[model samples]
Target: MRYGCFLSEPQGPDAIAGLRDQIAQAVADGFTSAWLSNIFGLDAITALTAAGVQAPPIELGTAVVPTYPRHPAVLAQQAMTANAALGGRFALGIGLSHKMVIENMFGYSFERPGRHMKEYLDILIPASRGEQVDYQGETLKANVRLTAPGAGFPVLVAALGPRMLKLAGTVADGTVLWMTGPKTVAEHVAPTITAAAAEAGRQAPRIVCALPISVTDDPAATVERANEIFKIYGQLPSYRAMLDREGAAGPGDVAIVGDEDTVLARLEELKRAGVTDFVGSVFANRERTRSLLIGAAKG
Candidate 1:
């Protein structure tokens, strides 16, 4: 399994600052890849493209870029451009965002997300791969081909349920997950996606599992801190179902918090449970956790 580090949530100048040094540090510290989120501050593709050119050969990814406002063509173009910029090390991770955010925040219909995702990937996959895609679906239509890409990039769908996961396995390269635990990954996720890929005659798909990590001297306090910070995720319907599937009450319940050895053991369990790419959203004991994880990656 490859180890990736989620870029720390930026503050103040990070919005406009170049990420070359930060990315270099991750590579220097032994991370195989790095993930950036698509928040309001800086777009993931743009940020990664800017920094990726300067960083070493380590991989760069979009933890997720939302697929609501942007057209598949536009996103595909950006993703292909970023891939070229990264010398083919970019992984495009996209998702259907929550209904509340789409409707309330963006004023778009959050309608039939599973179907929407299927339609979105239909256009996105081919078009982003330097192939012409003149397809029309219920939710979207695209007539485009990438004319100037250095190379093709892998895709990772942010999938949760069976329909979404099946789409991810068959249509896309793999799935990039958040807050999904080993129990669900082992019994439900791994089996479901692997079976779908095998039936479709595709190679084993990448299951990139992202989780909050903290190498802490105080596990209880760290868990409580994570609870306060990530509780809102528990309320989101999509995330709630994943949590329920794993029998986790809140984000804190799934957080891998402890000292180095403890966190390492749990991470081993995840790998055994079929997580091919492990991205840690480090929280408490930042440098300590990062340092320990860097060793874990190296070892």
Candidate 2:
């Protein structure tokens, strides 16, 4: 499995420059790819587009950009532009962000999220491929043709549930998972998505598994810190469902925290669970965790 790192956002006046430095450092550390999350901060795609230029050719991807805010046509245009800016090394990860954020914060209806995503993909996939899209679905409608420089970059969805996993495998290129454990991936995610992809005659799907990792002397303390840091994920329904599937009480339960050997064993387990890529969100003992991951990338 390919190993990658989740690039943390640096908060400052020159945050973009800081992000570029981080990407360059990741490249220096021998990381193959780096991911940025799209939270209530700088836009991930825009930031990556700007930061990735100075960094030498390491793959950059958005952990996810919410679909409710940007229309698919607009997103395709932006993603293509960003991909071009990054020398065609950008992966667009899109998701139906949680109901709380969509409804409460964004004031958008979160009804029938699965159907919304399916319709979103229906337009997005073809549009990203530079096709003339003239499709109308219940949740979305697009009638436009896009002429973009970076055509055909892979699109992955933050899919956890069966319907979304099916959509990810059959329609999109793959699935990008966060806060999910190996057991869930082996039993539920891998099987469901793989079957859907086979039925659709598509190539094997890329399952990119991302989890909090720390190579620490105090694993228990790290777990406690992780629980506090990522407590919000335990409440998000999509992530909550995956946590439940893994039989984890919370996000901390699934975090890979321990000595080097222990962390490597956990990564091996994820690889056995059919993860094509592993992105480490180093929460503690950052340098050591990244060292291990960099070695794993070379292996």
Q: What's the true lDDT of residue 254 in model 2?
A: 99
Q: Give the best candidate by TM-score.
A: 2
Writing each residue's lDDT as its tens digit, candidate 1 over 1-299 gives: 88998986556675434477778888898888999989676788998888778778789999899998999888988888888878889999998878888899999888788878888888888888789899989879987777867547899999899999888889888999998999999998899899889989999999999999999999999999998999999999988999999999999989999988899999999999999999999888888998888888998
How good is model 1 by TM-score? 0.97
Give the top-scoring candidate (lDDT). 2
- In model 2, the runs with Cα more than 4 Å from the true position are none
lDDT of each: 0.88, 0.93
* Candidate 2 per-residue C-alpha lDDT over 1-299 given as tens digits, one digit per residue, 9 for 90 to 100: 98888989999899999999999988988878899999999999999999999777899998999999999999999999999888889999999989889999999999999999999999999999899999989879999989999988999999999999999999988999999999999999999999999999999999999999999999889999999999999998889999999999988999999999999999999999999999999988977888899899888
All-Cα superposition RMSD per candidate: 1.3, 0.8
lDDT over C-alpha atoms for residue 165 of model 2: 96
Evaluate model 2: give its TM-score: 0.98
Query: Which segments of model 1 are wrong by more than 4 Å?
Result: 13-18
Distance from true location, Cα of 110 in model 2, Å = 0.3
